[model samples]
Structures are given as structure tokens and as C-alpha cells.
Target: MIATPYLLYLGHSNDEIGIKTSRGLAVFRPDICVGEFRHDDCGLTLGLPRLDFAAARDAGARTLVLGIANAGGRLGNDLVEDALAAMEAGLDIASGLHQRLKDEPRLVAAAARLGRTLHDVRDPRPDIPVGTGRRRAGKRLLTVGTDCSVGKMYTTLCLARALQARGVKADFRATGQTGILIAGDGVPLDAVVADFISGAIEQISPDRTDGGWDLIEGQGSLFHPSFAGVSTGLLHGAQPDALVLCHDPMRRTMRGLPHYQPPRLDDCLEANLRAARLTNPQVRAVGIALNTSAMDAAQATDLCARTADMFGLPCSDPYRMGVDAMVDLLLAMDAPAATETI
Candidate 1:
């Protein structure tokens, strides 16, 4: 486990979306978050107490979470120096960046010399088996997006919580770095070898006879050029019984790809459903989750209503509004189609 009571390092990131690793933990797992560590130029804040590495360690922080994210997940020279200093100050380090912390010679040497552990959250275990595509006993709901960072993890987490609140057994299966940290354990699908991505998910979320649900957090979009492979692998591996299409209504273009347009909701959902059918022919879409954080309450609600009407599926801003409607639809999958508009 990545020792908790974290000191979240924000570095100098000005983009809120880029610092989602820190924002996600702060919003969902605040009890374990001791404080925020930011450089002067950093433009964002999690509203946690600001603390230096030494102060954070003194405040019962055991690990420094390198929470910033970038296009390439690269570690800058200054960030590496900060990491070394954090280790020197009697704290272990945990990171989910594409750049492996264990691979950096300076960090590796510092870890050995200071007796500090470096937890590379992206590192997959060596023993994952190949996917059998055999039917599992329990139910699963996966969140697919029209683009990356379109609230897949948020929707999955909200659904899991709402299901549990209704006395339905549910587990949130994390697939990305932020989700892994929030769930405390998950297979980093992007980090797994392409051939074994599906198998890795299969290993993490095995069959359950308890009639519970596994709410698997999704990764990139099927429409995204850079990460569709990972998304397809995850969809096949999950063998999900239901799906929730998550989207950001405001995104005019695919994230990080200005020239590419976001997929139409109908097209995106159809593609995901077609891909999912490879493993579970019975897979169905239960709801739509929108990232309406950028809109007013009235606007968000209207958008959700229109979306639900369009798809004949329960739709809501899982964050601004509750996911109970979606949960209701998920639990009663035997009911007739709401509208068959799709």
C-alpha cells in the first residue's frame, strides 16, 4: 500500500485538469490528505493547509504524493529536486505519472540511502493472467467517455456510493492513477502491456457470487486517437453488464487534440456498446453522466434533462446532482426500454 496521510505535491501546475490527481484525492479522500505542497507559481489550490515537506512529515504525513499531471507525464528537473528533498525530510514518495519514479536514478539512489520507499502506482504486477472471456457471476457497470478526463472516475465513484447507500453491494474498481489512489488498489490499465490490459482488469475484479456490482472506472475514450486501444482493452476485459456514458457537454474538441472533434453522444455510445459486446453480449447502457461543473445549476439540470430525453436513459450530473436515478435504472435492468431512442 502507498502509505497514507499524504502530502500532495502540486508543483507549478496552473491547469486544474492537469492536477486532477491532487484534486481527486482532496475532494474524495480528504481524511488521508494531510496538506498541500505547492510551489509559489502554482495557480490552483485544494483548500488544504499549505505545508512544506518537513512540516507535512511532522503532521503525520508518511508519503508525498506527486500529484501533478502533464501531457507526457514527464518529471521536470525542479520537480525531481523537490522529490529528493521530500525523501530527505523523512517521507516516502508515491507517484502515478507515466515516468516511473523507480527509473529515475537520483530518486532511486535517494530512496535507498534514506530508507524510503518509492511507490510507483503505475507499476503493474508480474503475475496477471490472460483473459478467458468466460462469463463471471457478478454484475459490472463501466463508465465510457467521449474523451479523456470526462468524469468517468467521478461517475463510477458516485454510482458505487449511491448503490451502497441503497443497500446494494458495490465496489469501485479504479483503472487510472487518480482512481487507483482513491480506491487504494486497482490495475493501471494504461501501464499494463497492451496484450495483457484486459487480463489485468480480469485479475483485479474477479467473479463474485454475492449479487454485488463492480463499478469499474474507465480510461480514455474510444474516439480518442491516443488511448482508444487501452479503452477497448478495458471494455473487453471488464465484460460489463451495464454502461454509463460520461461526457462533458462543453468540450468542443477531443481533449489534448485540438484538431479532433468529440464524438456525437449517439455514435460514442454505440461504439462503446459494440466494443463491449465482444465480451458480454448482453451488455446494456443504463445512464448518462455529465460533467456539468462549468455550468449553473439551472443550465446543468436542463442539459441533463435533455440528454435523458434524447437517449431514453437516466441522465444526471453525477457530481452536481445525485446518481440515484442512474442507480435505480442500474438495479432494475429487467424493465422495458425507457424510450429506445438510441
Candidate 2:
């Protein structure tokens, strides 16, 4: 099923992950959400009609999703207790953390005793082979970001929605937990072995005769010291024909890691293209998706215009712009005559 209701946990100290999941759930439409989560640090809608574990269990929420994406995968004291309590209530647990819930003895025992399942979203299949790019077929696009948490997943989701609204067939491929939860089914690229990362994408989006579009959600940035390798792997693995570069105007340094400065947008875009073309010779960047939530309307508009002019491609905030500027480019490259106007 495309839509499934579950209790999403947002109690982690990293409120940013909670906020991202909260926004994602707005599109996913969970049955009920709990905790204080918001995009901008300012105003947050406290699910004050809050539903605790007991309340959620009574309401028949059999599945509990740990939606927070913290830096260290260690289950902290706060989340540990909450997860146990939910498990005690006989609710199955789903987690997207690098630290697998199944590996935790308490949760594992609790699940066994209760006969419930622990869904570790990051668990990758063994023996996943290397990618050949020969599996690539149909229309495909990827959302590459300038830095971490710069709206690659959000941009990809919005692009999928926009494509569908235009009566085009498209699918949003998830490479992270929040995106996987929203997408219902997708492989977590980071969980797979380094050698098979691209292979995972190849498996997720093999050749398609239906002429459908695959919006591959990018993981890390090519400039990020810790995650640069992953970005290169995804680009080479997916072999997308089109690409969208995502950025946040407010971000100066890479998230959490300040010593490393974020690269200029043009440099990031150029590098991503250069790396991607190694896999698919026809690959090209179609547009830019800017995240300007911190900026006021006037500032956002001005920055977007400048970015568009600088890149000589359509620039938009997927939340506000809906990828309208680049959809025409994708459609033209995918199907010229049919999508000439739209």
C-alpha cells in the first residue's frame, strides 16, 4: 500500500531530523504524530493533543517509527526508554538509524517476547553486486546537493509530485530513512556495502519500458569530507540522464562540521556533472532547487532570481517552486513532442 498509518517518534535531541520527518509526514499523512517538531526553529505545532505510548496503543497503532536521524547512531537515554515503553505496549518498532534496533538486546528481546517485528530500515542485502550502468533505461533524474541536509530528498519528492500532476509517470526513489518511510518502499543506499552502493540504485531503478521517470534522492554532497564518496557512488550508480542541484542559502559551512567550508554552487554543480558523466555520457543538470526557509519572502525571491541567472537554469524552492522551471527540460529530454508546452 502507498499509504500506511503509523506512530512516528520525534523525541530525539536532534530536532532537525524531527522537523524533516514532520515535513515529510505532511506529505505522508500519518494517523497521528507526537513531539515538538518544526522546520524553522521559530514556530512549532506541538501535537498538544499529544498521544503517548498508551494512547497510541489504545488507538491501535501497531507500528512505531523512530523518525529522528541523529549524528551518532547510539540510542540515547531519552530514546532508549521511550522505545522500550512502546515495545512493552506490543507495538512493532521501525528505525532508520545506522545503529540497528535489532542489534539492541533489549528491543530484540522485547520484540521476541511480544511476537512483534523490529524493522531496521538501514539493513542492506548481502551479495549486492557492483553497478554496470547497463541496467539504466527509461527517463531518470537525480537530486544532488551542495551540502548535507540541503533539501535533496524534499526536492526529489516535490519533483515527483509535480511530474505526476503534469500527467507524467514518475517515481521518487528513497535513499534515506525519512524518504523511505514516506515512499513506503526504497533501499537505503548508505546501509549497503560501499562496493554495492551504485548496484543498490541499479536494483532500485532498473531499465523500464513504461517510460516512467525515476527521481533518485541523493544522499551526501561531493564536497562533504565524510560523505563525499557516497555522493560519487550514487551519481555513478544511478546514471541519471538529468540532474537537479539543491542548496541552502543560509548554510555557510557543511552541517555540524564547520572546519570544512561549503563549496560554491557553480563548483558543486560542475563537479557533480563531471562525475556523473563518467557513468552516463548523456547526463546533464536541468535546474537548481534552493532552500530559503530561513529567509523572508523578499530575500528568497531575490536570491532565487540571482541563482537562476547565475546557473542559466531554472532556480526554485521545491516547497514553493515545485520544480516548474525544470520540468519542461526533463519532459523535453524525456519526450520532446508530447511535453513541448508543459
Please state every model's RMSD to the true fold in angstroms: 4.4, 4.9
Candidate 1 lDDT: 0.89
What local lDDT does model 2 show for residue 157? 88
Q: Write down the lDDT that model 2 would get.
A: 0.77
Over 4 Å off in model 1, which ranges? 12-15, 40-43, 70-72, 333-342
Q: Please provide, for model 1 over 234-286, each residue's C-alpha lDDT reduced to its tens digit, 9 standing for 90 to 100.
A: 99989888999999999999989999999999999999999999888889999
Q: Number of clashing pairs, model 1? A: 0
* Range of the 10 consecutive residues with the lowest summed lDDT in candidate 1: 333-342
Candidate 1 collision pairs: none
* Runs with alpha carbons beyond 4 Å of true place in candidate 2: 1-3, 11-19, 27-49, 53-60, 69-71, 76-81, 84-90, 335-342
